[model samples]
Target chain A: MTTATTTDLYPTRGTAEVLTPRQDPVVWGAPGTTGPLRPSELGDFDRDGFLPVDALIGPEDVARYHAELERLCADPAVRADERSIVEAKSRDIRSVFEVHKISPVFAELVRDPRVVDRARQILGSDVYVHQSRINVKPGFGASGFYWHSDFETWHAEDGLPRMRAVSVSIALTENHDTNGGLMIMPGSHRTFLGCAGATPEDNYKKSLQMQDAGTPSHTALTELAGRHGIRLFTGQPGSAVWFDCNCMHGSGDNITPYPRSNVFIVFNSVENAAVEPFAAPVRRPEFIGARDFTPVR
Target chain B: MTTATTTDLYPTRGTAEVLTPRQDPVVWGAPGTTGPLRPSELGDFDRDGFLPVDALIGPEDVARYHAELERLCADPAVRADERSIVEAKSRDIRSVFEVHKISPVFAELVRDPRVVDRARQILGSDVYVHQSRINVKPGFGASGFYWHSDFETWHAEDGLPRMRAVSVSIALTENHDTNGGLMIMPGSHRTFLGCAGATPEDNYKKSLQMQDAGTPSHTALTELAGRHGIRLFTGQPGSAVWFDCNCMHGSGDNITPYPRSNVFIVFNSVENAAVEPFAAPVRRPEFIGARDFTPVR
Candidate 1:
């Protein structure tokens, strides 16, 4: 494979430093270990394969990252397709990794000792970055993403990292039910629901079922939230939710005209691993620019 | 934004000529002139917002594309993280556009009168290439990707283009239920289910419902398939599927140890509109060389 340029592969000198203490030297007990996260807080994570941590970042830091994103989105050098431009222009723009590069706030959030300690306790080892992305869904301009699991897209491998993979999303905005907030399927991750594996012939029939079922599923979940007590993580800027990647999740359309933004970072263990970027039928242009990027090893 | 080089934006001299014949003239008809698509065929796409056409490209062509993809994947110059390599790799690899760029096979497939006729009937106007992509899902080596909708990912501006869009995928391998296969929610395209307005709070609870519900909505659909007398579309390599962008669709895991690959191309009207590539948040180092790419317009 082609090698990345020095600049593209290594962290820039101006890269942001994570302000939180690293858990590298600290070995903490399970989720309940003294810290912000409680063992019960991670209860869902254990049974269902994912959990959402509330408000990992604060509003001031969110505002700063938003400002940086605004600058980047405004850069003329960045040429996006009409659709992408429209999406970016309609929302507050920011790069997930860029914030980590420029601000100690993001770095600290990603490296938060409590979060990391919990990750290790739940996952059983150190986790590495699978990828990081920024979500900028502008009011009325936000695209309603679909609901699906992160693991379903892969070609199963022998040495694949365990299902312990987790995706942590840090809300830079107060994500509510109206502004294109993230939606997820709770316990779906726990069981290996045999792949639907619809055939070309079966696709049409299966699709109909999915559509019909989607509504009731939504209602069922809504009702359960009211009864069973659903948690609304109205995280202040800088706060985040780290959940299992396998959990079914998606976001609704942005109802308000304001931008609803967040940063999503995925982590997986490196031991006995054979992970690569998920392949799409098409390549994303922005990602192409960072093809040479590599984490400091 | 940095402008794409003319060479990278437009097809090379020989490439443009190759695609000419496939450029079947789009026939416009009065709105509602064409009869509605078959109800059984219309799954989530009809309800959610999209449709699917099976076997758009033949098996032979799919095999050839697969061979080329294998070569590309094995190429040392292709690294997931290297932008410069990705740029160069683009030239060596066979893009869907390039396939039509040099071969009559692709052109014939693009202009397949049956497919175009359907587009004309559905869109009420002539359609053209919005973008074409080569999706190579290498087994074991690939990472799991997110579940999302093509239309929701990109936004449109006033006077932009019709919200209706179609994607034609040509199967490159004999995909079975065992291997990761495509799944869809039928009839989802037409109705704006409550999900359209769901939020983060909805997501937390929705996830819980999925866990409580015990099985995914798709499971119900699978059982209903036979009861509804609906037909599945799994087939040989030559088969293809055409569907709406807004349709709820996803692929299953490649349980088998082989790659599940395919070629995806989208056709859209350019009238009073501009077509551009989708911009993603992460940057890949390889696409820098592609800076020279120009649009066909």
Candidate 2:
């Protein structure tokens, strides 16, 4: 009998596909007892692997976040910072990592209870920012991310050993259905898809702009989508979605004039801090996957 | 009785000075049986906490490395790279992190058994690059680093939990006595000096150029120097020194016409991977302290 160790629980980037049952509990705390999430809401999140909340913040906060995003993108110093990943073809600012460190506005938003409380509830422990970024999908030929589970990449490259992390994506601009909004396969987080192919050396240098290393193959994507069905998230500004790290998700290209932007923050349980990568040649940069595990006060 | 857990073993940045005994072994293997370093050499290292090796690389390799350094410094793309840290006063390139990824020559040097074999022996396990950089001190008015234990700052900010790391400094230029060579307090690595004052938030942004947070006070420096006499290192190009992570060391400013340059590489054992910072509010960038723990093959 083949036994699995803690380190090799969800192995990915192997030669062939190997789907393992999700080993860790999806909702860490007992239903209804944790943070700001209600029992029904927690049940919905556990069942669907994603929970969408309306009016996560007031309209004023969304405006402030939007203004900060514009200011950051226009600043030359921020553009020069290595954390800013520029798109390959469009030459536009694709994503800015460590927004909390760069801007006080976002830093305040990160610590705000409205956002962090639910993450703490879902994660079931004191959490730290594993990674935080502002993704900018500009109109006119903006690229779309291929379908993949983030936990696959995080496990293979960042050395996160479990699915105890959660992603909080708050919409700054209106997420219209026609504008490239996020899409996820509901209930797919129950299975850990071990992707085929090795993560290229220094894959992060290019993967940040255009990722293909840990993306699911067509067969796997088709099966998952067919099994769980795809759910598109389209909502107004101030809406937010909290999704499990392993949820199969991706977005489309934004060719329309409306640019889509969101503040993406990842919270990982301090107990699940990273080690050496499972399948990657090296660990990614700190800005991409934080080395700090200090709990948010 | 206060029993120290594994995480809080080497506590630093506390208000009071706490000198913990070194818990891990200095050298991993039996002296004579280890890699390139001999028994006598290992004894010297264990006794003094530092060892100087003669002729680590031949003249041709030194010349090639020097040429590559010049080429990298002169390249506009490298200058623009955020990894390049410019001197505050001179505006000359001070240091460049992750040179292995940027240059094939340095990458090959990192993988070379001559440099890495000794590290594996001393660290007692497979080692990986915790950090790599080329430090360039321009001849006129280049600033010097203050006397401080690297482990103090590393533990406080970079989240390195132990002293199972060694720094390899290979001279790329002639190190004359007047040209600001490195100075160390011999045998000082036995005691860990927990410095006073909290680490300033986002200290790495400034500490890289002028560090003040984790440095020892003048009183502490006097005591350490008096207890263990200081030793200066002056050698020809291609000579190298391997020093413990906790060695108290610094250098003087370079005012002489001859500039001093060296390739600095830090190797940490995979068994001694980093965790959350014990004191610092946030972890430094990955270029400064790598999150990757993949052992060198």
Candidate 3:
């Protein structure tokens, strides 16, 4: 155990906070060499650690995705699969993981030029899905996520070595201000906030439903939110947000009648494949953090 | 991988059946020196592989357990727990595992002499909880389990070296003949049926809710049922049945209005602790199959 900890790069669950400086560049490619985004849009992504695309998919595509989401939720086999996480309070499906493998519709969605090209532009390499899911926030009794960076979990538990991943959340429903929508901290991706609690054995089992470990402490969240003001993403159904893996993000519970849902896809550069977890006792299951690093065509 | 297979004592998932003879004794102790049972009762258990206790607990204790089961099923936190497996077709709680640790009422129940003494007598040593669960087969759409032996899974996935384990299922509800009641093959404990098909990665995740892999083939089940014959357990609430780990058993779906619930506990000999899985890629989580070998006093 001592030897294992000695070589740790991003040590978490300590008495005090250890903010590791970001070693990798936010956007790997610059200007004309990138996939589709203009130089000005690339500049905004590099500066703010996120870029909101007003029209990622057309209205027809959004409707198709919404129908697919409903079908997946209603399917008994999908609910029976361990990958589908149910809401804590209600019978509604909270999230269905490994969506690409579960549905051909989602499998095709991941390969789309609008989704895959932007990821290739940001990471500057052929990418594979590290994770993909449909996060559903049903109208009543939907739970919220706490303030935490995705990279913290991916690194500590999924064995993701670098922050060379981008998460694309394409809205399936209108993300009203009142509905529980993603809230990310602008410019907070540069520093990795080392968390302060040992990850429990088989942590993924509980953490999927309610993440307690590898979360930012109250002090760390307060400092980061103060340094970089929070940004709540509210848009029409087809809008999408591409954010850095290390950005501090969370969401509120949807108490309103309107539901909020998205097709969340994470593309990790093939160059940075997963290894053994840096802090956790074991790597999570393939459905949560994929080990099959086959590059997307 | 070749070296690992050569060393495997009980190989599974091949094209043909591999009926390994039982190397361990079903009832380890002789008559008078055993923990609680008489000579005739011990002989019956050795022959039939199962013995039923008419009244394992009083009516008041049964009421207490019923109340506790109701409480656990309704609690949101318990439902949120990954240990609580939901039904395939509905949001109903199917089974809540690690019951000894989950509820104080259950913790006390395991230590009761009527339960633990018989386990010690049959195992002929100090015993520990290899697994404990409250299986709730609620009427209307609750699923049934196909025929399978518990030891096949314990040996393949949990890495238990020997078949020196006993499972006690104490009925919390009156198990009517129409409702789903446990059916076991008499004298089936002598042969260890090495199941066909490779145990899928993270099999417990799916197997807990509905097992597919690591199960005996239809041919094997047919032969066993033909030879040994089947016996269905239907009794009033508080009745308990003690069976060897290797016995082939399964239950039907509770289509009747009455519900069938049981506090199922498995006790393994302290000497027969777990190691790396013999057939599976990895051992199951501690909640489903415990690794801790601390003797229960």
TM-score, model 3, chain B versus true chain B: 0.96
- What's each prediction's TM-score? 0.36, 0.50, 0.50
For every candidate in turn, the CA RMSD to the true structure comes to 21.4, 25.6, 20.8
The DockQ-based CAPRI class assigned to model 2 is incorrect
Residue by residue across A128-228, what tens digits does model 1's lDDT show?
A: 55455566665433445444445433212111224545667777766643344555545545432223222232221232112211112333333332333
Candidate 1 runs further than 4 Å off? A1-36, A48-50, A78-109, A112-115, A154-160, A193-235, A275-297, B1-297
What does candidate 3 score on TM?
Answer: 0.50
* Model 2: fraction of native contacts: 0.00
lDDT of 1 by residue, B132-226 (tens): 55555443222222223344333211111234556767677765432345554444333211112212222212321111111113333233222
Give me the iRMSD of candidate 3, please. Answer: 22.1
Which is the winner by DockQ between candidate 1 and candidate 2?
Answer: 1
What is the Cα-based lDDT of residue A20 in candidate 2?
A: 95
The sequence of per-residue lDDT tens digits that candidate 3 reaches over residues A1-297 is 355432456667676669988888999865578577888888888888999999999999999999999999999999999999998778789999999999999999999998999999999989999999999998633667767789999998988888899999999998865455787889999998898878888888888777788877666766776688677788999999999999988765553345789999999999888888888888899999999999998
> After aligning candidate 2 to the native by TM-score, how far in Å is the CA of A276 from where it should be?
1.2
